[model samples]
Target chain A: MGKKTFIILAFQISLFNFFVTAQSLPEVKAHQKLMVEEEEKEEYEFARESKNEVEMVFSGLFLGYKKFISSQDGNTCVFTPSCSEYALMSIKKHGIILGTANAFDRLTRCNGLSPEKYRKDPESTLMIDKLE
Target chain B: MNIVKEKLSVFFILIFSLLGATKGHTQDLHQTFAFANELIESEQYERALLTFHRVLFFGKGSYQEEIFHQMGTCYYELQDFENAARYYDLAYFAEKNDSIKIELTFKKTSSLLLNKDYGYAQIELFNLPDNLNPYFSQKRNFYEGITYFGLGNFTESEKKFLRALPSGNAEEKEEIKQIFKNLEKVEKISPKKARILSMFIPGLGQVYAGDWRNGLNSFLLNAGFAVLAVQTAFQYSIWDVAISILPWYQRYHMGGYMGAERIAYEKIEREKGLIYSEILEVISETKTD
Candidate 1:
């Protein structure tokens, strides 16, 4: 082939290869159920302290649970977070007076509530195993 | 005889002191490992990996394999599967026991697969035996299926998943079932066909790929560019077509076709993920209950 034709052909081949590579994708592994993080351990251990307890409660009150739910799998929550975090957030955001009355139900809802694991260094609210 | 006795006593003293120092070294290493574990628990994963590396470098203890495994866990948690797989590979080779070797290999396979290092994952799958303990065997097949799926060999993936389903526990069974259900031979518009269709009529490929809004946008954008290019060529000069209109038209047209194929594959993958995750939720709930 002529030099110009060879150059054109090479460019086309490279472009096609780029598109093929882009189409073939990788899988994301789910975190193993008892995969403990240091942050969660710290949070759980410090949770017994009155200061940490109030901080967690205050965070939940500030729609932290809502943000947590949105971050994981985007619009998909298994009952674990759906039940616990949503209830907590709903109660805290909507009803200060009724939230106090509905404390028992609220506690029951988030029984298996798990905070999302971070891809890097970040605060974790509870030990996953403890939540489980 | 007295000279010989004195020499033997001096040698024994040296041996005992060496033993004592070795014991102390081991204890210090253990304490360091314990501290690293604490750091890991606090979510200081990067530091923990460094600490584990330090322990590996300074210590020549029996816990070498275990330390490599721990490093793998830290990297895996960070989603740095490349490093995780590397450490797991090291651990797999170092592990002497068959069961532990199998376990580390399994972890290595997953880390490789997740990192999109399919070549290594494939090699690990081949190295793995089907005659392992029932649990490992099932896990082995499942990871094999995952590797195949990553390579987009759907038929092999299906076959492996079928094998895994029979031997898997409740969770794997459900996972396999969802995969089977999602990959059920429903006809999807061929991405190649979509690309061809859109090559002729710019938005058709996106429409076929079920991206209706994009399809319409692509159609309008390409049609508008085509009109401008034609008008420019006829009314003023081919220079405008060459300089501006043609490039935009070609770029978007190519993008539209490629995007359609990409979206098609992504839609199927996304649906499968949803099915799997929803089942996982139920399983999690049942376990909790």
Candidate 2:
């Protein structure tokens, strides 16, 4: 082969390799972009779902109790049966019913009027009547 | 060979870019976690709760236990004892060290106590080592006595009181003495006499017990209830009769009598307590002087 033809052949091969590499660049870039986007979406979703879980858990604690007490001192009792019942209902609705067991024990054991002397003096039942 | 080297350079650049992006992502996560911790330390609970949730459910494996424990503390401070108890239970279960476990258990027990779950509180107290702390032991026994009294297990209550008495300080000793004296007087008061005095007037028995203040208060309270009962009965409101008449009047009148007897016994005990305290104070002052 002549020197000029050989040189031309070498240039043609180099040009071919350049196009091939350049052609794959966009595809690689697209793939990387897609993966990054997916990672971001997943992270966002994880954060959103986690926030909802926390809110649901918190709401379960405040259910049935007013946000503010009308009393002058701003002290509100949340362990009353009505408030506790609401909390339990919220917990059940949120599929977090496991939190209600302790709450129930608290209401009945701590807040309810003692039933021991109720039979002896039925009139004393008014102790808890204020709730009604 | 030169063309191959050029291609290799581009490949290396791509790998380095990916590594940089990953490094940035991790740094962002760390920053977010740090910010959450700062909020917690500053006691911005509501805001901290949001950040902690981010760390707990979204952040990687760093500081998860600490975040959860902080969340429980937030709930406790908010007076949401139920939620506090739940989170403390979670923290207790997740804790690796014995000291953390014990501390979490104490917090859980405190939440239960605040929520008024005396039964479960008792359960938790019993589960703790007897030598957890002398102060805790004394408080545990005292609360146990209170729970027994609330449950009307007088014998058991007295037993607990006696157990706690020996460990008590001067103030506690006086308190225990008063409780013992009251128990004795309650035992001595005749149920028949209480019923009789109660029938005579709304709160005459209380007056006999030297609890004139309580007697007067009971008298007025019962008289008010009696008036309301009479009005409701005449109004032909059977519901009112059922509630206001049978229960309110009868119970208050009877309770007045019982209250008087109880107060009489309580007064005697209180006087003894006062005397005991006075004697102790005298001894203490003399020693200090």
Candidate 3:
């Protein structure tokens, strides 16, 4: 009710407000810190290892096979036409003879010798022959 | 009475404002923490690491130790072993409780090993208390052996491996023994012999080491190239020789020779792996029966 009492009340209110503000500042800062820390933790846990064992084995096998095939001696030849050139030679040997018949029927419906024409056709056979 | 009412009204207003400010601060903190948690859970390690560093250095006081440990975890995940070791060391220093300290120490040692800082890793292992768990001891010894092996201290490596050998189960014992044999072979393989045999027969070194397929392939490849080179030379065309005798021919010839030795080395490794797998399979079958 007095002027002195009123002044003291205002001062006390100001001090309480300052203290509350200061306390909350730290809590807010701390919360931000915690969020960042958690993100880092997640990253660490999920890193990938370099190479798996199965992948390594497959790589080695493929490389070895490639090296072997590339180094084949030119002189050595397979009996039933060179395996590398099988389709070409087979087409030259059989294509004209089989060309008279229905193309799909002669190729797919017929048994061994007739189907061999389509099988050895250079355009289709070249790639498959080398793979084998 | 009117004056008193006005003063009370002001006081209530101040109280409400203070409460609202505090609540807002708390909510902001909660949101930040949640965001960091989401990043960590999502496995964005590098970003999470930066976030953690921000928290550890500039965040609230209560979570300092936890933040440091999490930073170490991030480094470990990223395969930054040196940094991981450093962070783990700090974490351990901050909190010396037995469980936390032991775990941190193990992590530090593992990071050091991964970094190929074997000397320091060994020192850390030596300092581990006798009361440390046996499983930890086994792992420590295994890592120590790997470090020694990497450093070319095969004698020390063998000793460490012997110490780590498990005696509890027949299968485990056999597996360890097989590893021991591989280590012995690795030690016995003389670089001189490898070089000499490689010089004499191109791929003879690999064949001597039991890599038949590789040795044969190497020998055939080199011989093939050599024949091509000679034929190209006899043909007396500069372009022919250049194409077949030089460049790719030389590279492939040298490669074939090196391949022979590499094949030999790989053959030894493959054999060891096969034997180990066989032992493991036997153990698993025995256990099942």
Q: Top lDDT: which candidate number?
A: 1
Lowest summed lDDT across 10 adjacent residues in model 1 chain A is found at A19-28
Cα lDDT of all candidates, in order? 0.63, 0.56, 0.56
TM-score, chain A, candidate 1? 0.22
TM-score of chain B of each: 0.70, 0.55, 0.64
Give the least accurate 10-residue stretch of model 1 chain B, judged by summed lDDT: B280-289
Interface RMSD of 1: 19.2
Ranking by DockQ: 3, 1, 2
lDDT value, residue A52 of candidate 1: 46
C-alpha RMSD of candidate 2:
28.3
lDDT of model 3, residue B135: 50
DockQ of each: 0.01, 0.01, 0.02
Which candidate should be chosen as best, given TM-score against the real structure? 1
Give the CA lDDT, 0 to 100, for residue A26 in model 3: 26
Q: Compose the digit string of candidate 2's lDDT tens values, residues B1-289.
A: 9999999999999999999989987787778778877876787878878877887665665776777788898898787889888888888877898767767776777677567676886687677776644334444554555445445466776566444433213554455556556556545655456546866886677666665665676677777777777788788886867864676466556556656556555554455434333322322222110
lDDT string, candidate 3, B106-205, tens digits: 7787778667687887787777787645455555565565556546565676666555544334555466566567756654665457647866676677
TM-score of each: 0.53, 0.42, 0.50
lDDT of 2: 0.56
